[model samples]
Target: MPISDFRKKKLLYVFNVFFDVNQSGTIDRKDFELAIEKICSLRGWPSGSPQYTKTFDSMITIWEGLKKRADSNKDGQVSVEEWASMWDEYAKNPDNALEWQTQYLRFMFELEDASGDGTIDVDEFTSVCSCYGLDVAECRLAYQRMAEGKQEVTYDQFVALWKQFFTSENPSDPGNFIFGKTKF
Candidate 1:
């Protein structure tokens, strides 16, 4: 489906948050967590909250899935260069934006599957946090929540939470342009 203009703007805000850490127009592993934290804060979610844990797990899962597809070199890590390359390739397709978004979700799924075993465990969740620069305490909280019955996060739940957290308070304001849409 074609993303609404609002969703496009919202997604853009998210993309910028992830891509422009330090406002340097460049993103690295360190910046990734900052971006995630920023999104969490904007959406009224505490970084270490159970709600945040589920959302973060979902995102990591998607990232890992996308990495498997984008990391053609099989290096086990997707660098900035690889990300750019993937984006470029996707942009050339007729359904460029949609494909980009799909890839993004897939990547998150993969990130959550830290063990590459198609399932996310507490250890795998923590490993994702470490990759994104989360400290031990923060990572622990995430696992604690999951172990306490939070379980795995589904794509729809993740998307709903993302919309709630990232969308601007002013319904009509059409806020930040991070990912390329507001309702993604």
Candidate 2:
């Protein structure tokens, strides 16, 4: 099914408002750099730290994917129109969206699974949520629901959350909390 116009609008709003942290009116490499920097600072992972280097690289890789998958005009930034086009296509074919989201899910999971134990505990969850400017409290609840009493989140579960966060329309769904404190 084609994604509703409203859903597309909400996604775009998130990109324009939160993802475009530099207020550049478009999603670009600088915006991504600023975000990664914030994450590193908050985590106290300074330059040369393994986590910092890995996260920085992963974010850059993700940004590259966004450019390849969504930067239609290919002018070096993802304009609203380009984003809309990619999302609209994904809305029409959710599987296509998954193909794009899976890589991100793996990289994000690696970044957040700080323990290196292959599981995502509450602290890890909180750190990642905070990085995204999401409400940690709300995400706590969501994480509980996802983990379902498990101490760690499996990669399969992480992938499922990625799918749900982007594809589900019900705002109350736990996956909706993936972005943290969304206005919609």
Best by lDDT: 2
For residues 9-90, write the lDDT of model 1, one tens digit per residue: 4444444544545554444444545656754664467978985786576555555655665667776555445555554454
Candidate-wise lDDT, in order:
0.49, 0.73
lDDT of model 1 at position 94: 24
TM-score for predicted model 2 compared with the true structure: 0.79
Query: In candidate 2, what residue range of length 10 has the lowest lDDT sum?
Result: 174-183
Error of 1 at 108 (Å): 13
- Against the true structure, candidate 1 has what lDDT? 0.49
Candidate 2 lDDT by residue in tens digits, 1-184: 5566656756776686456879888999999899889878877889889978987888888788888888877799988778777766665666665443566678768767877788888888878777666777876776776665677887877777666666677766655545544446
Instruction: Tell me which residue pairs clash in candidate 2.
Output: none
